[model samples]
Target: MATLRRYDLDWLRVIAILAVYLHHVGMPFNGDDFHIMNTDSSKLLDDMMVFFEQFRLPLLFLISGTGTIFAFSKRTWIQFTKERAVRLLVPLFFGVLIIVPPQTYFEHINEYASYFEVYKNADFGINHLWFIENLFWISLAVIPLILFLKSSKSNRLLCFFEQITAKKFGVFFGVLPLILILISSKKYFPSDSKDILNLSSTFYYGFFFVMGILFASAEGTWIHLKQFRKLNAVLFIISTIVFYAYYFMPSEWISPYLTINQRWNLWYIVCCLVGWTFVTTLLGYAQIWFNKKSVLVQKLNEAIYPFYILHQTVLIVLAYYIIQFELNIPLKMLLLLVTSFPIIILIYRFLVYPFKITRVLFGMKKRV
Candidate 1:
């Protein structure tokens, strides 16, 4: 049977999604081309943004993969797929149709065009809900492998992962494939564009998803994580500090030791390292610290999906007018940040959760 509720994983999911929210809120002030823009931008903010960019989504995907193992253990293939579709797809479709348009509309509303005209154009796209769209498709694509791994013949392959991860050095092998795939992806597919409906970043995230399945199937995986928590934490910090050196250090200071391409290759490898270490470390430490259930986590865990779907739209729409207030960047960013959480919470509590039709459409379970 699948194990009892894992609150550590719940904690990880909540933290990762909140990081995503903060990232989106900060993106505008960093001078990036986002749905909204600030009048003045900061290189400091830009550097901070790049730092979080390294592991934020990768960590999220890894956690999803870990959770998938437990989720699959309890359900047959038919039930699993049905639940996945309802939980992931329903929100993506609903958000795309109802929630996403406002963000795009705000983007173009000040650009000499009507909201209807902007909404009519396909160029507006799905906005932040791309993660949901991509994940749903990936879940569908991996069904055959998920089934095969559950069979008898694949016992050896499953045993191999379990044995390797159980060893002191086995974690190295677990992380090696991820490092290689990340390096190869950067070297070959240098395009940094995102088209959510396409398999643009599939090879990248698929590796993590598969790793998650393997990790969860292995007995005592959480035990291994806890055993090596300190080591992973040290490596995570050192790698991150060095990763920042590449940006903060003067180019002339390090150019003699490494060329630009060499520097970037090294940086990309560290990105994978930091991402890997962070996920493992968080898994380890969270299990140690956050395994208990509580009302706060319970409420946040239940609300996380809808919060993610609604947060960006709320922020963007609010920001559309907040930017025009002649406030400083920090104040503007702060106002949007403070206003967003309460509004999203209130909406979910009253507008989305209470209605059965809205709940199902928003990817919540229907009321009894």
Candidate 2:
């Protein structure tokens, strides 16, 4: 059978990576302690980043999960595992060793004698490549489940989801498992930590990964998503508002009735809702608008993985210098954005695109 091509997913992947680039560009000014920080920070940018945080990584993971189905459809489990190891691990190792050290060097320049010193230490962890690392492991972890779902045994499981998605509001039920997973385990695991060892964060993202598989497994799910796009949009808006309102709400203003733990769990539940609604809303709308193919989309889809790998290190290096200039936050951000984007693309086009070795190191399929 010929593999199905999802133009909408291709479009979403490109858009998500671009959003990630923009988010990183805003990081220095967003009042967060990133690898580098600006002298002055913006509360507005901070608030915007906070809002985006609820759903950004979740969307990527879900899309990755969906992509996994397509990937696995073309290969046996062993082949799929090897492909993932090559596609994910090789780049992760390259990023940690080659690409990520510059960010660390710039971050703590005074502490290190030279970039080579930082590289020699090899203590720079995965940095932004954490996503790639998590994805590789999650891909391996889900193989058994994916295989089961592919077998005759999972027919009833797929059928159950199909029936639910057939209802007007049934697609929304997908969020319930995620909410429960988060609310119950968040206290122990603290979903905010990016450490792969952090069970809360793993489960939180893993649920989305699993959901992506289910969405791909159940053919009717996309129809429900598109059908309820409007409703999901409204809910996304409402949930975002509620999430922010709760975020900005003073602790002193809270009712004495709600315990601190209860309040925390409530916040987790709200976050799950916002994340689910945001993802479903975008998926639904993308189905309608981005399902058609484009030459640009195809190009972007090919470059996006390398772009993501290169973006943060480049952004951090540029921002380290850009932040020193006597410019306002917006101008600095604009300068960094304008300069780094093309530089990343050029590096990919000239350095990473043509060569088989560079292509493999950066997680692209080695061209013949």
Candidate 3:
């Protein structure tokens, strides 16, 4: 039942890291999703994108929150804050100013935007590194509350949340308003770095990270998820399909209400609930099925952080070439994915493993 047990975290990290890699590079054979659409069946890949999209950020939030509970419990507030800032904030700053700008510069230079313009533009820094910024910002924003809350009775907040989530009806009603809010402000809700001005993501989605830290205190929950293995497996598959079906239908056709209203508030909540539950539950089951002691899980868990930071840059490089060559979307995607794996491994071997950048960038330790 140990939450941070090597295997469980390893499995989740592998799932997250690979899912993210796929998100950027896309499925190996998916070509229609390229900037230039074609008559290929790669529409299915786009469908897959919608289905898997819900869980990537959310699962990451849960994993981080779960780890934070363990981490914060062992350290003083100052220690925890310093650790988080060092790990996330420092990297975010560097990513914006140094590590990320070259690629940003390269990608947008042809678009007639000035360097000054790019610097001034809020979204210009580290296009895909938004997660690191948000993670740091959310952690910093929530620490005071976390310190205050954690100082009180250990189980008081948890019991309160348990009381809320314990009820089937409460889950529906509690998430319904957030859904409405997201739908109302769909253009805003953490869609990009610019959305920081929109308070909903800060208050709603950011709060989920807080809940992740709080609720994940119970590594025992994995056991509960495991207990429901057979049932959850069926539900996960069905929900994944339902999630994809939404993407296949044009938004105009499926929900004129959403398009006219221009909000993801309703569907976001509904999908998030189903998505969060199934993804974590399935991961828990995977922890069991993959037997946690496997070598592959261990290596992947170690590589994921660097993989995350480095993959997008690699993906963009490949994306440009694929488009330039006018290759079939599926074939190009396949070639790009094949090319990316060796490049990612090589980068990790040099910049991270030998250079030992984890201490400076990702707040992680060596294991692989």
Candidate 4:
């Protein structure tokens, strides 16, 4: 068979990264503790962020997992490992050393006198680049599993997945494992701090990564997703509404019936449903609508990784200054979004994309 290119996945990855960029831009105004905060916060933005937060990172990881199948198709295990390291680690190191410190400096501008001082004393942490760090390690961790799934030895496991996907409700069955994992681990890992060292987060994201591999490994999985796209979409919408309703309801309303632990468990189950449904829904729709190749998609596919790496740093630096102006939250957000996006693109176009060293450092494939 000729190599299958998933243009839908390309589009989804680009879109997901852009959503993350938007999320970051809205961060300072979302009433959340961030590198910088607007003097006033937006309840609307906070609620919207909370809703999107349910599925955004999980969707990205799932897409990454699916893309891994394609990546592994052409290369041997060792070559695949080396490529992942270069693509993930090089930018991670560069971000930690060169890009991330400025955000930290701005966060502690009163305590720190200069950017150089912050860089010198910068703790060895990944910060927002934690996603890259997690992906690198998850890629390495799953190598053996991917190899086995590709080999004949894994027929039983693949067959089970095949059977599952063939059923009427099989696509939704993907959420069961995630639910079980979250429910079981909730006591130990209460919240995802987005730290690479957080085992809970690692496991949480790793589950989606592995799910992607399994979805790709079993033939007919995408067909099943497309077939049930409508149902998944409905579930996603319902779950999202239910999630926000439950999230915003007064605690006293629930305090009469459920204990705190029980309430949290219920919330986790809802979150799992919401996250998985949204992911499958998008996958299904992408298969139907976005599978066709496009020049724009190809260009974005090339540029998005570098864009992801460079985005948070640029946003934080800009927001650090933008939030200081005597402006309302909306105006500040508009300024940050409008200004930061083009700056990132220009930096990528003029500086990162044109040079081999910058491309490699930003995790783009070097030009031929």
Candidate 5:
């Protein structure tokens, strides 16, 4: 179990969920212009949405890395696996079957597979649920890797990580992933669904995650930086600029493949480094500030897991119904978010609340 509580981790969870939500909800307006992703009725608004796009899931992945460290510390491997399975896999199964199928059915009408085929192949918008599915697999996949590292033979690699932590995190954890991301952008790794679904995405993300674990084990790599607040602030601004520049550039100019892979870019890589540092510093500040002030941030912290499991499904279901209402784009998204949030909340209260099995499977424990 966590010896000390961290509300910043909880806050990170909420923010990540919101990012995924807004990315799906607001991305249409962001002028991404990718045929499969475009839905925003406003060209200018879509362009502006690009400014915040880089910050979206990168922040989520950082939070996830933090959570991995937390989870690794708190449970036996079996317990951790069970907990992660419930949190990740169950939602994936339900989301693929009960939730995303209609959208797949609708979108692929020309090549429409049967509902059974779509369910089996997950040939739907369940594609967006990749984060949850991939993370579940990654959590399981890393168990053996962690076991090997815990063995005596991996001591040298472990010591190297420890030695690297002696320098600034911006040098070790921060710049390292960005360096890999930039290299990959130039040579480019495929970012297809199959890649994201298998070990590729996990290994890709695992490097960032291990950095987080090392940072966490060091336990205040960021807290020590408060003395350099002014320098950190300046770097934060520069990193933000780099992140957005890469996000907005046309796919053709950046990619030889001409697909919207959201593959790494120099600006993207630089910004992620700066962005992760800034966010980590802010998290450190939030941790210290909340400690001194005695603030509590647990309501939605408790609500968030279940909210994540059901929210996208609810949104898709709402969109399924709302699209029939003949609403405009803004009205459509509004109806989707509005309709989904409450209905999902109700499901948490009713359908998911009465049974212990349901609670464990969907993360819907009654608030204590």
Candidate 6:
């Protein structure tokens, strides 16, 4: 079978990364204790953040898994592993050593007079690059499995999955395994985002990564997704309403807090359902309508990885200053959004794109 080139996946990747940027910028405005904060905060922003938390990273991990299948198509398994290490780890190390300290400095500057102080006392932690750290390990963990899939012995198993993807509604099975993972994570690890070692998210994100692999490797998935697009959209809308209602509406009958020890809760179940539906609906729509290409899409796609690596640091620094102006929430968010993009773009274009060493450090391809 011929490998498909998915421009839609590229588009979604760009959108997801931008959404992360927006999410982080919204963090301080929403009263989350991020590296920086605007003086103005909003309950409305908090609600939006909760909704975004349900799906954003999951979508990216799924996309990463699909991209992995395509990437391996062009290289040997060992080659792929090395590439993932360089692509993921190099940027992670660079971010830890260079990019992240500014955020931490701003975060602790009143306590510590210098960036060097923050650097010395701080653990050289991955910070936002925790995503990269988790991804690197997850990629390594999946290699043996991918190697097994590559062998002729796995042909029958592959065929079995392919057959399922060919069925009209069978793609829904992808969400079932994820539910188990989410439940396990919620019960044990409980998703402390600040804890880089949180096994909960590792297992949770790894599930979506596997889902992407299945989607890419299975036959007829694209057709099935398109065929079920309308249903997926309806399900997405319904799930969104249910999620928001349960999440935002306060009533004596309903409690939003979920505990894994309880065996199951409506919040956990709805989150899994909504997460999968949002992904399905987005993927189906993108594949159907966004497969066509544009120059801007190509540029954004190339810029995305580096932008993700650099965006938060830039945002935190800019937000530190922007918040000092005492602007309302909308204008602060708008100003940060408008200002940060160009600065990030300029840095990527001038500093990252032109140099061979910087390219590798930032997870870009070496200059050809």
Best by lDDT: 2
lDDT of 4 by residue, 1-368 (tens): 11588899899999999999999999999899988888889998898898888788998999899888888999999999999988889999999888888788778889877778875675545778989988988998999998998899989988888788878788887788888888787688777687766666778888988998888887778888888899999988888888988998999998999999999988888898898999998998998789997999999999999898889889989998998999988899999999999999999999999998998899988686
lDDT of 6 by residue, 1-368 (tens): 21777898889899888889889988879987777877768999898888888899899999998888888887888899899989998998889989988888887679886778876686466779988988888888888777777678778888888678667666665777778877767777886573546777788788889878867776567767877888888888988898888776555444345343542446777788888888987888897778886777887888899999999999989988898986798898899999998999999999999999999999988654
Poorest 10 consecutive residues of model 3 by lDDT?
A: 32-41
Location of the lowest summed lDDT over 10 successive residues in candidate 4:
118-127
lDDT for each residue of candidate 1 in 65-179, tens digit (9 for 90 to 100): 8777777877998998899999888888778778888887888776637767655665446778878877777777777877887788768887776677677756745567776
Query: What does candidate 5's lDDT look like per residue over 10-67, in tens digits?
Result: 7766777876676666543345532133343676666556555545555666667667
Model 2, range 1-368, lDDT digits (tens) per residue?
A: 11678899999888888888899999999888899999999999998888888888899999999999999997999999999999999999888888988898999999988778885786577888989989999999999999998899989998888888878768777889998888877878764778789988998999999999998888878888999999989988988889988999988887687888889888888888899999999999999999996888888898999999999999999999999999999999999999999999999999999999999999998564
Check candidate 2 and list the clashing pairs.
none
Q: lDDT values of the candidates?
A: 0.79, 0.89, 0.62, 0.87, 0.60, 0.82
Candidate 3 clash pair list:
31-329, 31-330, 179-265, 182-265, 183-263, 183-264, 183-265
- Candidate 6: give the clashing pairs: none
Q: Worst lDDT window (10 residues) for model 6? A: 254-263
- Model 3 segments beyond 4 Å from truth? 1-6, 27-42, 109-124, 160-194, 202-204, 234-259, 262-266, 294-296, 356-368
lDDT of 6 at 129: 91
Q: Model 3 residue 87 lDDT?
A: 75
Error of 2 at 161 (Å): 0.2
Better of 4 and 6 by lDDT: 4
Ranking by TM-score: 2, 4, 6, 1, 3, 5
Model 3: per-residue Cα lDDT over 1-368, one tens digit each: 22345466557757776887887777433553333223444667766676676777667766666666666766887898888888777767766775565556556657646656556775445566777767777776767766765664656765666565544333333345546555556555545233455665555556457656655654444454556566556666765665656545576674755554443443565576665556546655775766547777766776777778777767766665565565777677778889978898887877776655644665456444
lDDT of 5 at 242: 65
Task: Look at candidate 5 and tell me the lDDT of residue 306.
Answer: 71
Clashing pairs in 1: none
